[model samples]
Target: MKHPLSQFNYCPLCGSAHFEAHNEKSNRCTECGFIYYFNPSSATVAFILNERHELLVCRRAKEPAKGTLDLPGGFIDMGETAEEGVAREVLEETGLIVEEAVYQFTLPNIYVYSGFPVHTLDMFFLCKVANTDSFKAMDDVAESFFLPLNEICLEAFGLDSVREGVKRFLKR
Candidate 1:
């Protein structure tokens, strides 16, 4: 497949057709001297382990991997820290409130939304959910459930980063 920025033929700032690849990750407009950088976006994922040691996972409701197992998280919004963003995603996907969490790890991932592959920096967090009672699937999740850490099927996770992160999460 071609690079994701290949579609960006015109300069976004000046709407000039003189834009061309300036570097591996940026485009520069010769006419307007504008450079557009295709930087990786920030995303977050939560690893909420219940008292029984079952990790809370969700079935994706949207495309790119519908019905696949995923952690409760999403892209970090503007003005939110990774911790804040992760808690918001967990709340949106699983209806759980994260009281505390620690940044565990990070993984680079490709998130294909609307058929466009966007590079992302996925931040994984070890979260403490208040309780599992409010765990109702919503938002981007079609269903919410817990899987025993040992019995988790890594293949069920659709995202490569999630699969890798879960491996590290399970090991430690």
Candidate 2:
């Protein structure tokens, strides 16, 4: 049997099979002493609300939670600040430009892709859109709509992190 780290057999820089786990979260090349660390990716999701306090939600168009309700956000881009990344993602998914975002909280999540678990730090925000009329389902979103906070069904969210975020938001 092979350890999961064996999946990354060779050092990316030197192509040497001497690359082995230095720790649970990293690999080191014995030949060149180059180390590679497995780092969690940062992602963002927004809770967009109108004056009426109805929250905007989207249905994911892809797996691991296809067709399930999700917030209007995605992975933060490199070199982008969390606020900027979140706004961009919200705009891309829901077509609503975020005028402002208030950082709410963060959650650790495991996003499984192709049988490998990708860890993520998911940042949540309470956002105000520049315009509600701009709302539309776009990008990886199958549908977009609003639901009152009192009427929100957490079970409709496929991701546990998102569900927990919503639960916290409702309490706030």
Candidate 3:
């Protein structure tokens, strides 16, 4: 697993080639005395449940976990709150509008993107939707559907944090 900071060879501020690893999570430019710290990006995961207690899930359409079962969510964009990000992701991927998103917990994860490790803090939420009637798989989701809580198979989820989060949710 490659560290996210290892991908950068030059300083972003000074554009100097003297940028070197300063610590486990940062780099320093010897020429400009500028230091950049690599922090975990904020992400969200939705645990949407219908009246029957069936959990909404999606099949990933992209790599890093393509073709695997996943929750409807993604990285939080700039200028967006975690709740806003999760709701937006749900609508984008599953066509479901989240009316309520109650924060449940958080988990640390390393999402590999392109080829670099992207450290993320995944916020989990117990979300509510008006109905599943408008559901359609879109964006990064290849397919979307609901599964009975008892029938959810942890192994089907390819992402480590998602599988662990599902396990935690199941225990609740």
Candidate 4:
């Protein structure tokens, strides 16, 4: 049986391209019996706070929720730590350098866009800006601004991941 969602060219354990459907939920390599589970990718995100205590937010220019406000964060690359991913994503999206950051929370959610399921283990962090004056939008970011926490509205940004992350930070 073939899983409707399973698509693989090789066995994850043996790196062999020859594989056969073991069942509706798994595949077995012809060379080695290795099963690959359909799972979500892990992502790391951050809620950056400047010296003035203003939360830094960006208007997303890309999908998965375009034209919406979000925190300066993104996917964690392979072999990269959560902290590293948070810093890199913040810089890539907002060009803001983070001075210090601490792990906040984790959310396991499915991001569905255009009929594609994006399973993500989202790791959230609280980051402090090293140089607030140098912050600027780089790529996949239409605009960036620091807003008072109280002014943040859920209606303006439909992404509950961001809203929830910030709200959690504020409460702590």
Residue-wise lDDT of candidate 2 within 72-163, one digit each (tens)? 87788889999999999988888788889999999998877787777789999988888886688989999998899889999999998999
lDDT score of residue 112 within candidate 2: 74
lDDT of 3 by residue, 130-152 (tens): 88777999999999998999999
Please give me the total number of clashing residue pairs in predicted model 4: 0
Q: Report the C-alpha displacement of residue 71, candidate 2, in angstroms.
A: 0.5
lDDT of all predictions? 0.90, 0.88, 0.94, 0.78
For model 3, name the residue pairs that clash: none
Top candidate by lDDT: 3
Compared with the true structure, model 2 gives a TM-score of 0.93
* Cα deviation of 119, candidate 4, in Å: 0.8
Residue pairs with backbone atoms closer than 3 Å in model 4 (clashes): none
Between candidates 2 and 4, the TM-score winner? 2
Off by over 4 Å in 2: 1-6
User: Candidate 2: global Cα-lDDT?
Assistant: 0.88
